[model samples]
Target: MVRLPTVVIIGAGNLAYHLALNIHQSQVKLLQVYNRSRRGLSKIKKNTGVETSSSLNKLNRGADIYIIAVSDDAIRETASAITHLISKDAIIAHTSGSVSIDVLNNLRAELCYGAFYPLQSFKKERDIDLRKVPIFLSSHQPKTLKQLSVVAREISDKVVIIPDEERSKLHIPAVYVNNFVNHMYTIASDYCTKENLQIDHLYPLMKETLERIFDNNKPQDMQTGPAIRGDKATIRNHKKLLKDHPDQLPLYHYLTKAITRYYDENN
Candidate 1:
């Protein structure tokens, strides 16, 4: 039988919110929540009937694990404040994809410190069905890894052990897929507004783009559009229109040129 560890969560943002709810439904016992915001405290308290406080000293004692789910910048600072409160043997983990496991290294948690990154975008208003998301987990100690795996498995069916180095690599592509893609959408929205075109018209293509990837393993192989086909006339026409939108023109030209160069060099 897998032994479920007693856990405390140390944040109140979207990740922390859904994590607390997910852990509550698992075999692990949720001890308490610690956060700096009154609203964050009240939010989790309302959801799980769990005790919450802004003071680090007030953090629940005797817990087997602590998940620090604060923003990336505040993670180390928050971990510093609560290291003394937790049991020396208690596992300390964070849920960041970009930040490394070494951020918690200075606290001297050693074998007790690691990462529990969930590779999915979070929105507070949306309900999280963890079973559908991939969880990239890592730990410094073998026992700690086992304990965390059980907790993670209960929440996500797609849980996998990812080394810190590989997790870092995965984060690079993640930024392109989530952040950079969203910026592209914002640009498209701006262009639509200027052209008096309905942004809603792009919804089907946007949805299809995502659906294609979910149904395949390699997205680059599924690439489409004029640049891929070397349609010079269409490219020239697009660049002509781009002359009026200097900012977007540069970005569009840069991306299209890079893609064209890549195709020429490889294909």
Candidate 2:
């Protein structure tokens, strides 16, 4: 039988919450979780039955891996605080897409440091099957990379070793597709609510749009509506309708012109 590495997680936010649950379910032994506040540790401890701590000084020292799943801003500070607590031979990694592995570079002389970024949007309320989520791992040391890969594979089926420069580039497109696109949906839903229109009616259309993209269809090739078709009258009418919504008008106009210009140059 293969020995799975012991794991310790830091943070109890959305990504951390989901990661803790997945690790608890996997073959890896999740020894404990650490959060800055006591309240944040309650749900994870209750569900996973793993030991929890509000202080970094109380983190489990025996775990083979320590995953710092805190916010991008706090990753460095969190790592620095736990530097003296964990075993020197243990592997420490951060769960961030945009933040580089260098955030933990300060600890390289004494310990193995790397990144364990999960390229998926996490929401604590929503339970997602992480087996399909792509996990990106990176480490300066070959031995550390191998160890990180083993832990990543146990939690996710799709694991890739993406270095810092390349991984940072991927984050740009990720934000556009996930975060920016979600904001567009939020704006549309708000508009529907204000107009007394049932947003649920658009569910099928929204589902189909995503399905088409995932089905090996290019987004630009699948483009429809007045913007791509160059229907000037319809675009004018949409702008007019959005006149009351001053904030939304600029976005509509800008997207329309962008789509129009893009197709004109390409086609």
Candidate 3:
């Protein structure tokens, strides 16, 4: 593998956009950017000043690494389609926490392959301190793992060689913290709109909640809520308030019951 491998990024979505930006920012050669559609191609080209292509056929086969930053459903399809397009020695990686390295290799039986999962949510417009984000690396071959890990370390200090078994475990907590928590935020914002309340009013609560999580023990050990406190009256009152919002009520009740049950076992 080249010291700083040349890269071809596939897809033009959030992950691709940010990955392209970071890869270039780290002074790695971002040779090409490809997307299935031209919709957001111009924006990425403008920001990175790198050549972009909407067609996979236009990709440079000589690039040292190909990072498929596409969606989970498209990982296999894109890998399979691009297998013959690149150098057989080129390392192909996907930035999916849930997808296995075997899937990438299976899709392209002979080529070197790996997973280059950056375990963080990305928004293209906002700058991320990539070093702070954990980039999980996995590969069937040690040379492939070393190459991918070298590429990963360029953008993140927290690179770890995680096997599929442990990588899948990491994805679970990632969903709990980022995806599921973000959904709760979405629900909160909608709730605020319906109740004539500003969602920003919850910022302090959110801030302190995060502070405790970071400052204290495990989330379960740091757990504090009416459910865990066994404050039945408060829980009842909260449920009554959500009664009119039937959609949110179910999750609230279910989570409350779950929290209560967890504490019940402890007590």
Candidate 4:
């Protein structure tokens, strides 16, 4: 972006942590990091060897790009506060999947606003493998789009230019595949504990399920097990077992109905 543009990140959470590391390693010149807390600022400063400040007013002046990797709810507020501190020509961006690019439209510099969304789960303690993850980029201005794309491609080999509307849809599927699936795992873990069963028993199935779909083709095409076999007895027993847990009952029935419907049509 702008031939190794000087960048500043305004957040100290998981997304910010990994993004700063990726940017620094790519020789993109991270000018500084901003956080309201001393502890968060210290962590980012220590990890990246980059300048950090707890005060937004003390931020480094005249950066080429300002990456606001803050929380979704605080995006607009933070952007508004920081916009006054940076140069008018400085391009501002946020790393959010769900927030539209127009969230920053009210800024004095509309042409310098954009979105840089990384499609993957992030944890504060865990280091993200940025090389494999795909980064989606969109900007209101064509020149800003080109600049952000160059910056994104430096840290990720799989960078795609997605339209704002399409990117919003992508976020929903991402929640289903990543966030919802992880919650399902947590539920399974609780079930395993209650039944004196090991969660390890499902590890192979879980891993293989993902590999098969990605390595092969559609999941509907690779259908198998009791549902595909039309084992009504097993299905009935599952619903019966889930009756005591009313919360899970609906999910069980919905998935079963979906599978049964698929088999009914495909067969």
Index of the highest-lDDT prediction = 2
The candidates, ranked best first by lDDT, are 2, 3, 1, 4
| lDDT, each prediction | 0.86, 0.89, 0.87, 0.86
- Clashing pairs in model 1, backbone N/Cα/C closer than 3 A: none
TM-score of each: 0.92, 0.96, 0.94, 0.92
TM-score of 1: 0.92
| Model 2 misplaced regions, further than 4 Å | none
What tens-digit string does per-residue lDDT give for candidate 1 at 1-267?
756788899889999998988888877789888888776778788889988888866788788888999999999998888888778888888999978888888686354888999898887788989888899887667777787787788889998888888898899999999999999999999999998999999999999999998997478787889888988899899999988788898897888888889888987
Candidate 1 segments whose C-alpha is farther than 4 A from its true place? 1-3, 109-111
Please report, as a residue range, the 10-residue window in candidate 1 with the lowest summed lDDT.
105-114
Query: What TM-score would you give candidate 2 relative to the actual structure?
Result: 0.96
How far off is residue 44 in model 2, in Å?
Answer: 0.5
lDDT of 2 by residue, 19-94 (tens): 9999999888899998999866899988899899997667788988899998899998988888887778998899
Off by over 4 Å in 4: 109-111, 265-267
In candidate 3, what are the lDDT values of residues 30-84, reduced to their tens digit? Answer: 9989888997789899998999998777877889899998889988898888898
Q: Please give the distance, in angstroms, between residue 208's alpha carbon in candidate 2 and its true position after superposition.
A: 1.3
Q: What ranges in model 3 sit over 4 Å off? A: none
Task: Provide C-alpha RMSD values for all models, in order.
Answer: 1.9, 1.3, 1.7, 2.0
Clash totals, every prediction: 0, 0, 0, 0
User: Which pairs of residues collide in model 3?
Assistant: none
